[model samples]
Target: MAELVLDPESHFPEELGIYFWLYPYWDQVSVRGCGYMVRWGTPPLVISILKFTPLAFMVTWNAHPGFTIPHTNLCDFIVGNGAAPVDLPLGFSNIPPQRYPEAPGDEGIVLHTPLAYIAERSK
Candidate 1:
């Protein structure tokens, strides 16, 4: 099992908009991926993983009706309340990055994870 945490300062959003946070776990023993979803409305903003990697993964946004934003991971541009800490299942794939390709979707502006989680998991 691996423990994951979200950095409040790095992951929190300063303004309101579609936001996403990704947790990528990769190691010789296993690779686990997990995170949360937030939106302005019911069901909140839903985010799904289209591709996974040791270093990073690609996520897609599923906005509710009236939400016209394209699917994209906006982890870089927008700031948010940061990612809430969560626990994820453990397992890994032998697949390589080239085997998985990024699809067209909304741009992810805010991407971050907790430094503690990474450190603990790496150990």
Candidate 2:
């Protein structure tokens, strides 16, 4: 990876040790491709052994990303929240990026996660 130069116009105040705090993560496994901490889906998805293009990557669970629960628990303190079960299949895929959140009723093809979600998943 190339050197990460902090922009002079950064949003932080001029005196805090923010750069020192961020250096570890900012310098960790950054690559030409992005990294993601995804919820591994059950019924593991299979794919062809074809070689990936320069932009392709597999979202494995190493690097101690902390395994996320496969299901959602919605238990309230007083009224008791309803169960928001996470029924999503948890495996990762190297599918190409697409302009998702497609037109209404075109739900069949969509990568529902937000860009921020994709970016922050690794954190």
Candidate 3:
């Protein structure tokens, strides 16, 4: 029998990862035949049965021909290894970077540079 190898480009995941902002709206996550925009938030997890997944979805959806994240796109995929769970502190959406310490109760700090942005940038 001939062996078949699935390259990264052709691999399709059984489930998809979800962004944290969509956590509350997990019910809204669906597999549309078209495609979906995915951006990393915290870590990979399965919320209920949603898979709360991220990487898999991106690869699968993007595998389709002519897939693209537009120049005018409002979002970009925040990539992560999805290796483990993320434990964010209260009101802190992302893990604080070494250069920038967590500023609790400091709205000004976030106004210009949000922790989420910092985390995304760190990635």
Which candidate comes out best when scored by lDDT?
1
Q: Taking the tens digit of each residue's C-alpha lDDT, what string does model 2 give over 3-95? A: 113453333222211100111111112222223223334222111111122222222222232433222111111121212343322234333
* Model 3, global lDDT: 0.24
Write down the lDDT of every candidate, Cα atoms only. Answer: 0.33, 0.23, 0.24
Q: Residue by residue across 1-123, what tens digits does model 1's lDDT show?
A: 011134445442323233222325342111122233333233433333333234344343444555443323354443354354444433344433331222222322222233212223344
Candidate 1 segments whose C-alpha is farther than 4 A from its true place? 1-53, 63-83, 94-97, 103-123
TM-score of 2: 0.13
Q: What value does the lDDT take at residue 10 in candidate 3? A: 37
Model 3: worst 10 consecutive residues (lDDT sum): 53-62
Model 2, backbone clash pairs (residues 3+ apart or across chains), number: 6
RMSD of each: 13.7, 18.9, 16.6
Whole-structure CA lDDT of model 2: 0.23
Prediction 1 global C-alpha lDDT:
0.33
Query: In candidate 1, what residue range of length 10 has the lowest lDDT sum?
Result: 27-36
